[model samples]
Target chain A: MKQQRDSIPELVWNGNISVEIHQKENSLTYLANLPRHSYFAQILEDLKRLFAPKVALEECWLSSGKASIKWHWPVGVLYDLLSQEDPESATSVPVLWHLVFHVGSFPSSLVVPMGSMETFRTCFFNALKESDYVRNGSSSLVIALSKPETDTYWNSLLNHDFYDYRPIATKLFTSKSRIIPLKIYLGADAPIVQSSASLGYTLGQVLHKQLPRLFPSAVMYSLLKPVLHGIVLPSTVSTDIMNRDFCYPDGFLHIVLIPIST
Target chain B: MASSINAVEDQLSKTLESLQTEEKSSSLQEKIDEIISSYNEKENRKVNLRFKAIGRTPLLRKNVFAINASHRFDKVIRFLKKELGFKPDSSLLLYVNYCFAPAPDEIIGNLYDNFSVDGYLLIYYCVNVAFG
Candidate 1:
């Protein structure tokens, strides 16, 4: 049975446990004061320094089995979480935080190993291509790279640079794990383009929405259908196309976009 | 006493050797052959699909349909569209096991064999707004 979204209290919780990332010039100011000696606080303290001036996660709190992260600008937190050396060995915080974005709800407080983002992206792309939504060779891909608002260099780039220089052209794509604000141009020369923000907030959304727009509406019957399905992803599955280690247990991740009634 | 211990040790060693060689080891080629044959056999089999409407959607009069295992999932989607009188442009989402949406090109046999709950592959279909 489909659990109503509001019924899942853990997902909807607005408790004391919260993370507030205030964007500052050249650095993000984090403002969470977890207990000094606690293990959760230590994890946050270590992660807080990762992005420094480029992207900062300010006051972060983990309490009552719920965590909240707030950031106005796009950052690579999702990429960092999955690309870590040993995700299975990582403590609960990073894994849960990653899950919060993928699935609108968290099935449990325990942070189990979800596979690397690379594997997820590959599996997703393979599935999409197989379904004929995405094609290669003739597909012109424009990966729009934008500096996170927290980066000091962000203000230096003019709007013309955004239009003229492909982020990849500027050599921003040195690493695979870093979030590449992708603008997928479907055809060899299709011109419909959307920025990183307006194309659905998450990476999954961009794949479904913007990518399909590249195709003729009459030719492509289904728009960006989710490469990964369900309201929640499972921890493991023997039958998933990706490596078994990366499979969600079953119903632990949701990729579908449903309209919310206000 | 020493002679008796020696005799028993010799007997145990002989038994162990015989047990070790009782089973013949298959080569890598033989293992590969076996996997290919089993896969081919499974691919040739036919399967039944059971479709059920979810939410406020109208009920399908006849729920069960039979399809070849080798057929692509697109066939099933096309059939549903015709049966439900859905326009070609209208959106329909089909989920296998009521969990994940299988790609249209995915084989029906593979889905039926792996995810079928009660001898029938259950596909839950929902009419959704195409863009949302």
Candidate 2:
């Protein structure tokens, strides 16, 4: 049991998303494995150095096809949201995320700005504050975090240090929260479905509550399944366990709904 | 193929529109139907929302809006922005209960069911990030 529990963090924290960022003007391609929990802004400084004289860090943004990647969401959430796969397809190879790095024409309406560390910190904290509120019914705990605690917490997420983030999160979470902070992504065109559910609820209960029509009660088998941390969850999976063990550093469970093979 | 992305969106919009169309005409059959239904749908009807301004956000002269139960929370945010004459670039945050901005896409009906009191979904709004 100890080994099983230990593997959860080891698997989640070390999970790398293989990213391929291509330059449009020249065919120069930059390939690297991005940490699933790190935001694009956290890694942009290093990426900008590769093309420093040509493109500044503040001027850079990544896109998949025409969709403007929301920089504030964790890189893994972006991958789950923007990409789709045929479950029946025979190939078992992992997905290599393709992104285009552009220097100009930042679409302010579509995506928020994250050019500076301050902007990134503010956005991250704002999201964290909201998630904490959903879990604890107040943002006081997050606001009360000391300067060093705040820095360590933020750096742990950016650095993908699950061990460093664990204790601080434990201090904040304190107990099994009544309401689980959760965001459900349906599709690209559809806006995200962010609804709070109780800690006692199972995956099936939450699904049926938020999306009853899609996950019809009359149907014996669900036509749709929820994916978290790049793995599909069983209907009986406990929301509390998932929240404690697999939730993102921001304290919210990011779930993606995809069609299951009938 | 039967359940494409558009299928779900269409169902959601139709449910919202149907609730709005028959908002006031809550027939006995509808009440019975809700009771008999296997799933506990929040309400097969609309919600009465009252907006309260906070932290320099302008108060709405006509604060109450009968929002459909199926509409997402983003609609409320967009409506507040347009009514308040906020520029497209401006930021407006909405909160419920006490001091947390629920995600913009939260369904209005769910918020009403979970947090409403006295049959009014009292939403608090701010022109800036006031809570944190």
Of the candidates shown, which would achieve the greatest TM-score relative to the real structure?
A: 2
Model 2 over residues A105-211: C-alpha lDDT tens digits? 98755665565787777767766777777777667788899989999998888777877888898777645467777787755544455667787777887777666
For model 1, state the Cα shift of residue B132 in Å: 9.6
Scoring each candidate complex against the real one, what DockQ results? Answer: 0.02, 0.14
C-alpha lDDT of residue A232 in model 1: 21
CAPRI band of model 1?
A: incorrect
Candidate 2 runs further than 4 Å off: A1-5, A48-59, A86-90, A174-176, A217-221, B1-132
Report interface Cα RMSD per prediction. 25.2, 11.1
Scored against the true structure, residue A241 in model 2 reaches a CA lDDT of: 77
Q: Estimate each model's TM-score.
A: 0.29, 0.72
Model 2 chain B worst lDDT window (10 residues):
B31-40
Candidate 2 C-alpha lDDT tens digits along B1-132: 112223343555466446547775765334223322312233346788998988777888899889877676778888889999987557887877555565544567656754566789888988777755
